[model samples]
Target: MTTSKKRKREIDDTQRVSFALSDQPVTQLGPVLAHFPSIKPTKSTSFKCYKTQTQKPMIDNEDMPFAEIPMLVAGETEAVDFYSSEETRRGSLGSRYFVGVHNKRTGITTLRAAPLHILTHEVKALKGLQPAAVSTLQRLEARAALGETFGTKKAKLAIRAQERNKVDISAMEGVADHLQESILKNTSTLPSKEEAKASADSTRLIPQYDIDALNSSDIYPLHNMIPKPEWKALSISAYMSAGGGAERVALLPFKRSNWINDHLAIAFASPSPNKTAIKMLIYISTMIAFHKATFKDINKEVIQQKLPMVPSVVIDGLLSRFTETARGSIEARRTPEKGTMLLTHMFALCLHVDDFATDTSVLAADLSMEPAKVNMLFKTLGCKVNKLTQSDLKRLGLPDSAGEVKRAILKTPLEFPKPRTRRRA
Candidate 1:
């Protein structure tokens, strides 16, 4: 303790392996590296790690002598990979010349394009022309500068004729139309143009015939009217019988003779021909012809006239049936004062007689009918028979006292009556 004693060096035994005393610890400890007896290490033999690849079939450099490699220029060398990394940029060009003509009257603007040379020349010539013309030229310049490709110079102007107010062969009506015409005319006159046109004319894919000339005469000569082929085909049909058939069956012969005998032979040849109907038709025809000859025309009074043999009621019934069947007349708007009359006949009468006047009462008196009937007839016929309002009269350039305005024209035909239901008892 008295002598200067140095503390034993503190060993860091944390790195050393720890041991635990166990029943079999002795057996496990015998296998440790320290338990093995040390032996002298042997020296490594001097052998190649990898055999050197036998001097790669020695190339004769003397014979090869670096086959003259082309020397790329300084700039060329840089350019090779220089562009490789960068994206190539390009621009698309559009129409070159722009010649727009504005029609002040029609308000239509025509736009056209010309070659660059033609457009430049046009602009130079357009110096002192109309402001519109000058502006159009300027537009062409601007378009060309913007890298637009002008189509062919369609509008050709004479530059030298700018000084003379006289005939500049360029001036024409409808500038755009003239431009197109000029282009067509110039192109058509080129070499081989006539030959090409002749070839085209000879090889027309669709044959064309003059429609008027073709329709002038019947191509086939069956009937004077119908083509021979059509008449022949129809006559040979199974439906056409010698005794009786549809009118289409007799069409071929009917055209030749439409006399009473022809009608009797063809139309009345049906098996169940009604004798009574035939008599009635004969009577009506005789009455109609007699009235036409005597009174010049048949009216309601003429129709009501009784024949010597037939009863008045029979005549009335026949007339009613005839009016309905022949004229397609409707009996509507019947009043006690004015009995039912054929509306179609009344409409024709009114159209012929009435002056688009508001005086419906006067019209009724003249037509020998009630005012209400007159109003209904005019209304059904789509005529504006009512009095015009004050505003309307003024707009029509008529005095307020213009009680009688013109009769309104019929705009549309009368509509048929709707189906009526029977009253339940």
Candidate 2:
């Protein structure tokens, strides 16, 4: 036979392996075939058949080992790529959902897996529609790409309203200045009765009374109406016939008396007097006395040293409690050092008591009386007597000395004193 025809016969008669071979494995099979020339594998081929006959391919699946493969039921089996099916590929990375995304600007495609709760282009992630979410990723990206701020509708409206309602502070100041100038220009003109009444009502002092202690008699009286009894309400003839004019008549039944006496009776049932208030009054009076006596500025520390018995805290608290009135009074009493007046004994004599004797002899006798003489007289009689000087009497708000206590008396009503008369020879 010819050589060509003999080679053709050898190729056609070589033994074939009934197995599928892919492009990758076919190269690996070259050495095996070199060792065993009888193995001639064929390239893998997919058969196209009717859907009814499609079950044969799935029934004969060789890709999965028995341990990895699931149990097959007697029905048209799904052609599942056991390693790379949608379910297997999705579950391979655990439960996270993955989405295919492409960025238009960068022209890059990527598979992004997001958490279960976050919304993405993934159909599995879009479980609910969130209407109240103020911003979306697309809106944010659009703003960023444009390189400008784009506020939400609500924020835009609020900004517009604020701008519209913003007040001009300069204009308000100008208006206030104009109004003040107008008021000053019209100062000579009298206000109308209504305006005056309104001003008075608006500016009326509001008393700061403690509401919890509103029932105190000092704050609110029991009744505002004046009471007149039948006895006092009667005619003069009837009063005279009933012996009302001769002796005291009871205004009301059951030991009727003046309200002052009644109030005093009620006070008798109360606790002891406020010694703190008395001490504060005495300390303040003593400070004033020292200022008059020394003819010096009223220094609190010096006054405190002089009156060591007085409590500093009590006086400070009292001054604070009556700050408005007490401050002005204290400031007035504290005269400047430059024009300070030195009070003389004659001035002190006039200041000692509210009553003044016009007679010089009587005044001289009263002022010159010695307390030791009175005490000696009382000592011989074995009588205890607290002999007090005019200054001590003045401290208790009592009538003291022969003349008048000038500080105790209100100076407004009293006329300037006439020059002291010369004694007749």
Candidate 3:
């Protein structure tokens, strides 16, 4: 009671330590101790503790790596674990253990590996296992016994080398005799070359109308003047059969107007008014042949004047009839071979009758083909296709300042170039 307590020592506010305050936690710190490098913990310091509640058990009851897991019924327990706790394994054995789910309503087990399982409920027992009502076991046994003897019999019936080597002269003789008889019959039935030629000549319809009497006005004179009997007998197929130069000449009249009038009349006429309209258009084409205008140009003019329209298919078919199609080209436009021949014949006829050559442009326009292609066709026909010189223009009665014009002139005893041959290496 008598000892006096020393007064508690008090530190000054100026000498006390202070800390900075923040609302958010500090995520990063500057490299203050980075230069001192890190040291890994030893085995003693990094020891694992199984006693801890945070540590997982050796075998974890985790979900398997599957899109869906089989759900158990309310009262039912899950299936027993497929893997042992002692075994150091990863992933799952659920796929192997749970083959499939059984549908109670359908009574069908829908399996994951159905293809591998291959359920054969439809396959019946072998005949040996269960004999048919009609076939008794004794009969089956007898058949089985006969199989060996049948195989042996087949083997014995097979021809040996010696027997196979022997020639059957009688059979060969019979075959030869049959062949000889057939040959004799064929030869007897066949007509002689001269007889065949005579028959062909008789079948061919000779031009009945006088060529001298024909004029430009007579567009399809051969078909128009000839009777149906003779007209039908004028075989285009026979003319085309010769092909090459002869075919070109024979088919010239067909390209003019005869072919369409004769054959295509039925095609156009089936649809009534088209026939008359198409024929009028063709007549107009013939009338305006000297104008150097294309069929398309004519069509355009007709359309502008509110005339009957021709179908594109009909026009295409007409073009195909008078043109040779180009092979192996992106632009499948046809070459105006038949058309050029037709023009050539018309030009030659004009030269014979009117005593003058025709212009290439006029021929091209008449055929509704390019003038360049028409000129090429003329050259192929052994004609001289040349640009109009001043003299040529003057002879043709064109003005001195007339633009470039190409003319095709026929020469006597014309020599044609050999056809080009494609070479493959």
Candidate 4:
């Protein structure tokens, strides 16, 4: 035989062997298939099928791994429906297939999943309707967006009609004439010249301290001679209403029966007498009596001493709970209406020294306030301003020739001015 014919015969024999191996079972031809690129050996030897049965037969109860299967059913087969024909026949659709429904009562448009036939019916109905003008469409859209209904528009129109039909009494000429007549009647009822003069005379007879009507200087001088540390400590204590201790007695001399002796003892203590302390004590006492003190009244002393003032935050806190600004002036005094126990106790010294009828001049001298201003404060407290005449001076053991001097006499059953009532027209 020729060499070419021999090579062709060898190639045909190899092809026949491969074709024979491909026809055998995978398990039997495992090693032979592994050598071929087209056939791969799987890692697992478990049985598998690409085409699976849709319906599964229920397994026997004895074949189940768990003996006590609570909800097991044996010998029953389940058939699966792939096309969902039941849902289609029932006219139920998913959320993606929805239609907008407008509620006339609520004036709200809501989307709901609807069947295909209902959607087709709505489309046909809309097609049969006449096209709206641009202006009319815009107006309807605006009303829908604003949730304005026909009933609401009707209510608004009814209100406008009512307003138009109503008469305005203030605009009528007869009403104006009636108002003019009333004004003339009111003017006629006013007091006559003689009655006015008598009223003025009666008013003069009553002693009234007209502080607002006075043309006095607002400036009140202050002299601070107290040591910085001592004054600061004392101010903080007074502001806080602190009473140190029971044993550290006689802090306020005014409270004791022997107040004069106590005052002298405190004024002339061991190391050195604090003359400035006495002045401050008296000033604080006056402030407590009136329940008011001004920053302008103490600003000069504070500036002169070069002491650090209390923080505005602390002052604001104090104002909220304990104090309020005095009326009539922005630079007015702050009246510590609440938490005045310590201050009142301190002020007892002044009352004791003044024999309950405080002398305005003496208080003014200590507080560096005008005598008239001090007098006004006393008058506000319902104290009677009496002139110490020759007879009065003699009775009080003073020289008769000292001349008449004014003094505020504090009396029991005090009479205060009645608050004026406002008349309504």
Best by lDDT: 4
Each prediction's total of clashing residue pairs, residues at least 3 apart in sequence or on different chains, is 9, 6, 0, 1
Each candidate: what lDDT?
A: 0.35, 0.32, 0.38, 0.39
3 versus 4: better TM-score goes to: 4
Please give the lDDT score at residue 157 for candidate 2: 71
Which numbered prediction scores highest in TM-score against the true structure? Answer: 4
User: What are the per-residue Cα lDDT tens digits for candidate 3 across 1-425?
Assistant: 58768987798655554433322222221111001012222323221111112243443223322212221111111321111121111222342322355555444554332111111111123323644333233454465456546646654344343246656565465566677668867999899977875565333222122223334323223333223443233333333343444343333332453323333333333534333333333323332232233323333334323312223333343334434435664332323444443454333333322113446675455556698876765554445766657766776566766436556654444433344679998
Per-candidate TM equals: 0.18, 0.17, 0.22, 0.26
State the displacement of the C-alpha of residue 265, model 3, in Å, after optimal TM-score superposition: 33
Q: Candidate 1 at residue 142, lDDT?
A: 67
| Candidate 4 lDDT, 1-425, residue by residue in tens | 65554544455432332111133332221110011123222444222112123355655534442211112111111221111122232343332243455555554555433222111112223445867433433454465545435447776576566557756544565656666668878998999977875565444322222333222111111211122343444432332232332322233323222333344455545356454445455334323323333333523233223322333332333234334445665442344334332233233334433444445565555545587766655554445677666655664565655345567664455443444679998
Q: Give the C-alpha miss distance for residue 68 in model 3, angstroms.
A: 99
Q: Write the per-residue lDDT of candidate 2 for residues 191-230, one digit (tens) a residue.
A: 9977875565343222121223322222211111111231
Q: Please identify which of the two predictions, 2 or 4, would achieve the higher lDDT against the true structure.
A: 4
RMSD of 1: 38.3
Off by over 4 Å in 4: 1-172, 177-349, 387-405, 417-425
Error of 2 at 394 (Å): 27
Question: Candidate 2: misplaced stretches above 4 Å?
Answer: 1-295, 314-425
